[model samples]
Target: MFLNRKVELSLLENLHAEGKPKLILLYGKRRVGKTELLNEFARRHRALYLVARQEAYEGQLKKMSSEIAEFFDDDVLRHSPFQNYDALFIYLAQKETPVLFDEFPYLVEANRDLPSILQEYWDRYFSKKKTFLVLCGSSIAMMESLLGYKSPLYGRRTEQILLEPLKFREACEFFPQLEQEDKVLAYAVLGGTPAYLLEFDYGKPLLENIRDRILQKNTFLYQDTMFVLQQELTEPRVYYSIINSIAKGNTRLGEIMNDTGLEKSKITKYLSVLKDLHIIERRVPVTEKSPESSKKGIYLLKDNYFKFWFRFVFENAEYIEQGRQEKLIGDKISPVLNNFAGFAYEEIVLEYLKSSPGFPDYIFGRWWDKEEEIDVVGLDSSQNRIIFGEVKWKALTEKEARQTLNQLVEKSVEVKWGENLKSGEIQEGPEKKYMLVGKKVGGKKRLLGDGYLVLELDDLVEN
Candidate 1:
């Protein structure tokens, strides 16, 4: 279950090795293994783990008093002299142990001024006391604001770790028997979220797991997307409409607003919220120097599970509830799923290169003025080298792969990185490299020269 947290574990070890009880803020989206990682680290280091309850101020105080009393073997907290948070901190400051505020955002919700109170205690007491305090949360907004310059606990945090999901290859380690293609399919559907990946029954077929565990009525993840949205926003319906619109392929800003029946101005805020949650993303052409400044961009659902759920489940809830789930899936979802698989195959290529040998400094996603687009572009600006990649989801004979490679080369020229360089010189080198990645590739080594590397699924697995 702990597949790809080596880097995170190392960071924790380094912090503890510094011999200072550091204040750390660990934050990420729900089900991203934040609490799991936290508990794992705590168990290894024998640190005290205190999960703060999302209750009223008095309730939290009572719960904390009980835990603290138990932790320190004190009977006095029942009638303790701790007047406020300052006194509570003064008491805990006596120990040199790690104090974790799990779901710290919930505690803040209970008492808005908790950050200020913590800041007071941290500066006046805990900093000198050398108590390692970790504040962790799933609420992205709360975590960002707490560490921002304007917040009371701004400078008090010695470290902050924003945990992202496990990568594609990392997730594959969980199901060793699954083929690379099936692993890619799983990645596309479940994404790298640990909770979702762990739910898969390795003994069962992947599609069966998808149908039974993911799409079954009353399943935990069946309505997970809605729950996550409703928890974060008061006006969930508008956001749902926006998400559904984007999920349904309304990528253009105007198109999304039109589909959602929301005003364009309001769409911006909704888009921002979704972007902040890491659900949807806005993308522009790679050639654009300033992507944010460019007006001609498209928005898409970024999370695979959310994308899949909204596209199939949420959109056709009526059909599903009417005992036509299988029929609806066959008629509507399967076609999209096929196309989704092809797109996901391309992502697998990029994910492979991200952790491959000759790690590039910059990886630009290539999109042409026309329908022709390259799957992955690995550019080493430091070396002035570009690696163009082509991905396909269909079976490829030697003849078919050669044609795809040729097309990739043709599209690579559309990116005018050549013009940006000197007349006779490349950015960091005198030559560029081409990489072909697809479902099927053969005789690439013979057809292309030494500069080209043909990579198939097995090749990527090895790499």
Candidate 2:
């Protein structure tokens, strides 16, 4: 059932081919398939894999000793466990085999000095041997800290990978039987997490899958959002309030503070934590020079499932608990489903444009001001061009497409992006391009003939 991650497998294989002592770090959020990728690689090579659990240090050491003894066929070693982490690593260092320590943070939690012990062993023994050691974890912050300047393991890893979720198109591969539009809807709900995608039943209707698998009390995904928060944050309720506020249309910092009744400072800290977790992100206008410090930065949930949960599931928990799934879906979700999909469709189009042929090298983002907003904006400094686009979820006729195009053109002029870039290297006026992305464009041929980049659902899915 494994899919994608060809590049990751290739990287591991290449590292193994080197036949030298190497320290590799693999980390990401939970359910991102880090363990799956590691298992696949382990199966391909003569490697010993140990998954650390939340247990006493002695228990972990004994379990690992048993696994190692089994792996090496050394009954004597199994009968006599190593005295400490250092002795165990010393024995492993001479074996010249790949040893993967998955969920490494759990081991660290059990023994605070494990990192220092590994560092000492690595410098004295393992570093000189043809050993491939991998330290993997789901705790993003903890895993990243191992490479920070303050950590004992800093500057020790030969390679590191911060694995990300699958892209929209890659996720579509999970449900080949579903239509393109259904695939999009499924992606919007389940996101690109491989584990989540497997929970969906493509044979069933989309709403049925959502109700039975996602919204029902006994299902895995019913409280998944809360579970993720509880695992990562100390104050889950405050974080939930912040996420709920954003889901309820309070994106701005002030708005979130007002809605959540939390102090601005607390909001800032919680927002930073959420951003690090990849559950939320801060967005600024595409044209802004310094996005990090921009005053217009607004927060949004980056995970589609969280966005959907807060909007629909969290908001209507009572109705769902009352076994009113039918009314809830028909009344609350059906009315706003199209509108919600409209926002997700914008993101999908942006992803499409990133791999689209003929699109210049650019930084893609949204653009907005007090007066107007553009759904998609691409700033190609190399080509001295800016692409302005609008996305409509409904089918569009020729006249509607033309009007949308004209409106985009008019808004592009108002922004005067060229003027903003005048101080930079590109002194000339930037060429402007117009694009329309929607479910369907009735007169796509005519629109293409008229020099417009019109993309329909089919075009998006196919490309």
> lDDT per model, in order?
0.77, 0.86
Clashing pairs in 2: none
Displacement of the residue 439 alpha carbon in candidate 2, Å? 1.9
Which stretches of model 2 miss by more than 4 angstroms? 416-428
Runs of candidate 1 with Cα error greater than 4 angstroms are 78-83, 418-430, 448-450
By summed lDDT, which 10 consecutive residues of candidate 1 come out lowest?
421-430
Model 1 has an lDDT value of 0.77
lDDT of 2 by residue, 1-463 (tens): 6798888889989998998889999998888899999899889897899999999999999999999999999999989998799879878877867999999999999998989999999999888888799999999888988989888999888999988888888898899888878888888888888888899889999899888897798888887778877888898888989999998889999999999999989999999999987789999998887788999899999878888889999889998889998888998988888788888889888888877776758778898887588899998877777778999988999998898898888777656365564222444577767889888998999988988888889888876
Candidate 2 lowest-lDDT run of ten: 416-425
Model 1 C-alpha lDDT per residue in residues 1-463, reported as the tens digit of each score:
4667888888987888887758899988888888888888888877777788767878787788887788777888866735567777877887787777789898899888889988888888888765778899988888989878999988789999989887777777777788777777788888878888888887887667876787777888887777778778878988888888987888889888788788878999889988887777888766566889877688977678888788788888887688776687678866667688777777677776776655647665755454556677666656656677777776677788777767776766666554564212443543556666666666766755645677777876656
